[model samples]
Structure formats: C-alpha cells, structure tokens
Target: MGIVTSLLPFSIRCEPDGDVLCAHLAKGNRQIDELREQPPTSVLFHGPQGYVSPSWYATKREHGRVVPTWNFVVVQVWGTPTIRDDVQWLREQIEELTNAAEKGFRMPWKVADAPEDFIQAQMKGIVGLEIPVSRIEGKRKLSQNQPDRNQAGVIAGLRETGQEALADAVAEGRRQPDDFSLAK
Candidate 1:
C-alpha cells in the first residue's frame, strides 16, 4: 500500500469518473479490459489462480469423473481517481512506495541513489494517477460446497495442471464453509 510495486507484482490507478489512467500488467497476453475514452476508477488487481477440478463439484454424480474447473481470489476497489500533476508530489509518493516495499529487505534501493538527470528523465516518461477508495470488495470463488474428499481431489487436479494457486484458493475457501458457496 505504501508505494512499492516490486513486492506486489503490479498496480493500476484510474480516475473517479472512470475517465483516464489505467495500467494492466499480467501475463504478457493478459487483456486490459478497459475503454480508453472512459477510465474506470474501479481498479482491480489480482495475484494468482489455479484450476479447480470438476470432481470438486458436490453435484457430481461420481468421484474421479469428467471435466475440471478453476477457482481464484481477487480484489476490486472503486473510488475517485485523480491524475497527479505535481512532479514533486509524484516523486515523493513513488519514493514512499518504494521504501515501503523494500522495508524488510537488507539492502533497499533508494531513489536518491540514482543520478538526478536519470531520475528526472525516468520521471518524465511516467505519470501518476490517484485512486481514492470509496468502495472495496473481495471475491474468492472456491469449492466450499464440495465434500472434503472432493476438495482434496480438486487440489490434486490443480497440482497436476500446474494451477496450484487456484487449487489452493479453492481449498482455503472450502475450509470457511459459507453462503454463495461454489459447491454446485
């Protein structure tokens, strides 16, 4: 939250009115689903996901059966986004973020350590967008509905497909046992 994106893989900022400034960095081919003319203030950042085995479906007729599925955890925040025009503020904010990200590291990089000219040039090419949260929500779709055995099956299947993240999330969600459960 401070300012470092390195610890966290990526982040994006857009405007309050959904007007401008949104960046997306995921898999090289991951799509950026936002219209340019309309910048959405609801910025969504995701971490990881893996496949959920269909065997996890509680409604399944039998175990070790047909197709599989996927599960994941995601976060979405909506707010008024502002574009920072003050260069000084942007620099300070970026520095703060960097320090926060590197707080636990033994040797953290410092903005001041870089040459002034190089820093200025780098700053010139980049812009900052402010996103103030007005609404925040978390969505974690997992296999809570499945029986313990099926949940294990899903985890196994996810591991097999190399989608361990998704499998792990579904497994965790199942441990909670709640409404909107994905058992079906």
Candidate 2:
C-alpha cells in the first residue's frame, strides 16, 4: 500500500521505557485501518514554531540581504505500529493522557470521574497504537544562521508578539553551537 498521510490530533505519549510511542485512533479511521496491515509508519511532532520577519534582523536595516523565515523545532520518528484493542491497556493510556493534559487546571478531570460503563463504551470506538521507535530525527531552526544582534532582535520580537515559547527556543538556540558559516 502507498503512504497515506494523516494529520491526526492524537494524544501521543512517549513511554517511560523510551522505546515506544503510544497514541489512539478512532476504530473506523483510514489511518487505523492502514496500521492494521503492519506497515512501517512515521510520526512527526512539532514543537515551538513561529513566523520570523526580516524586520527583526539587524542585517535587514544595515543591508537589504535578509529575508523572512520561519523558526521551528520538529521531530520525526519511524517505526512499525502495533495495534491494540485491549481494554486495560487503553484505559491506562487514556488515564495518563488525561492527567497530563489537565495538570494545569485548578479542578482536573479524570477518567474515573465519568461512569465506568460510559468510559468502557467510549473505549469501544477507539483502538490504541504502540510504535516501537526504530529511528528518530530532530531539527531546531531558531535563527541560528543570523548574527548575535539579529538573534537577540528575533528573541525580542517573538516575545513582544506573545510567542514566549518560541522566544525561549531562540535564546536556547543561541547557546548551542551550529555549523552555519554566517553565525556569529
């Protein structure tokens, strides 16, 4: 079968064992159907990302050589999937997911807050997936190609626009050495 791309809003979690990733799919979704065939799969995860304007670069004012770009962090994982329909495993996965998502709430909701029968019934409509990671690649593009002043400008621009996460990433990127010849 050919590759079928899907942009699923999955509640993904990396297992403590560090070897696998877990998520779920609605039973009838095409992606779930394809995974049942035991084909190789790839999952992409996006971290902080944002648009960058040339106006934020010091070089743009000193010289007209800068162009708008995007700053982002991403990870891609490849593996063969194991489809699971076991109720117990599904329950555990969902509970962990729920706890993580609701951690910031003053009153966090839980799976047990709902009736057991209703939770069980809802589980029937979804299947769990475990992908034993075979390979992982990551990239962080946080204005590493620019000079120090320009990078500082980007950090300020991102923060002023309410992109604190991306701004932090840019600041962190400044500490990491890169191979870009233009970096200073």
28-131: candidate 2 lDDT, tens digit per residue: 77787778888978888888999999998888889889889999988787888999999998998899788888999999999999999999999999999988
Which prediction has the highest lDDT against the true structure? 2
Checking candidate 2 for backbone clashes, the offending pairs are none
Residues 1-184 of candidate 1: C-alpha lDDT, one tens digit per residue: 1222221222334545542323222222212223222254555656566665465454466644546655667766665545544678668666766776788989998889899999887776555555555566677667665567777777777778787777667667876533322110
Worst 10 residues of 2 by lDDT: 175-184
Give TM per candidate: 0.62, 0.88
Query: By summed lDDT, which 10 consecutive residues of candidate 1 come out lowest?
Result: 24-33
Regions of model 2 farther than 4 Å from truth: 8-18, 177-184
TM-score (C-alpha, index-matched) for candidate 2 = 0.88
Cα error of candidate 1 at position 159, Å: 4.5
